[model samples]
Target: STEALSLLEASGYDYTNIELGKEWFLLGGEESVTRVALSKEVESGATSLPKIFVGGQCIGGCSELASLIDNGELDALMKKAGATKKGEPKKNTGFLSFLNL
Candidate 1:
């Protein structure tokens, strides 16, 4: 679980680790809204274990995350979350900038 979380972190995603049967309730709380949202993603078909949510959308598990990272799609989503890789902001340099306004 730690390794999986590391991959997400390495990919510039902000995530929380929840130990099932131990932190279940704690993760379900309002303070851990992202954790709860991730859990729902797992419950639904949107994502498997080690779930991820970007802007309230399920981004899927570790393997899926890896794929997105490999394909550069994960970086796009991270930017959408107002997050940066290694604390460096991502600049919109492509046609997407036309919609930035």
Candidate 2:
């Protein structure tokens, strides 16, 4: 879970972290309600720990997150969610940069 959090932080996207306690396992509690809600949203139908959701959509676990980062899709998703990079904007060095693409 820590690895997942680290990856997300490194992505430079604004995010909120919610940690659930043992009480979350107890039925009928607020945490449990949240868990249930997450389960419904999760595609696997199992609420796994360290699940990452972007724009109210599940993006899977740490492995999935790492994959997105490797393939450069995370930036697109973050932009779609209205999150800009934390620091200076990325410079475009490709040929399309001349067109401000």
Candidate 3:
């Protein structure tokens, strides 16, 4: 989880970290079997630790995040999600900018 957090920090986009307790489940209501089913929904059939979600969609764990960074897609994803780098002001674009608000 620390490694994942490091990668995200280097990416410069703000992120939220939710450290689930050992007893917490990702999608399962309260049963282990349902947890297995949740993993299946992602087609991995196994949940990876330190899962990352962007724009409310799961993008897999640390390795996946690394891959996105390596391939330069992470920036695009963050931009699309309207995420700005920490300490940077968001640029108003399109209709909002035209309105001059």
Give all candidate RMSDs, comma-separated: 9.3, 10.3, 9.4
Worst 10 residues of 1 by lDDT: 92-101
Clashing pairs in 2: none
Worst 10 residues of 2 by lDDT: 92-101
* C-alpha TM-score for every candidate: 0.53, 0.72, 0.68
User: In TM-score terms, which candidate is top?
Assistant: 2
Query: In terms of TM-score, which candidate is stronger, 1 or 3?
Result: 3
| Positional deviation of residue 6's Cα in model 1 after best superposition, in angstroms | 2.3
Ranking by lDDT: 2, 3, 1
How high a TM-score does candidate 1 get?
A: 0.53
Off by over 4 Å in 2: 25-31, 87-101
Alpha-carbon runs more than 4 Å astray in model 1: 22-48, 86-101
- Predicted structure 3, TM vs. truth: 0.68
Please, what are the lDDT tens digits per residue for candidate 1 over residues 1-101? 55557676576444445444434445545555544555565546332345555555555666776788789787677677665444454543221110000
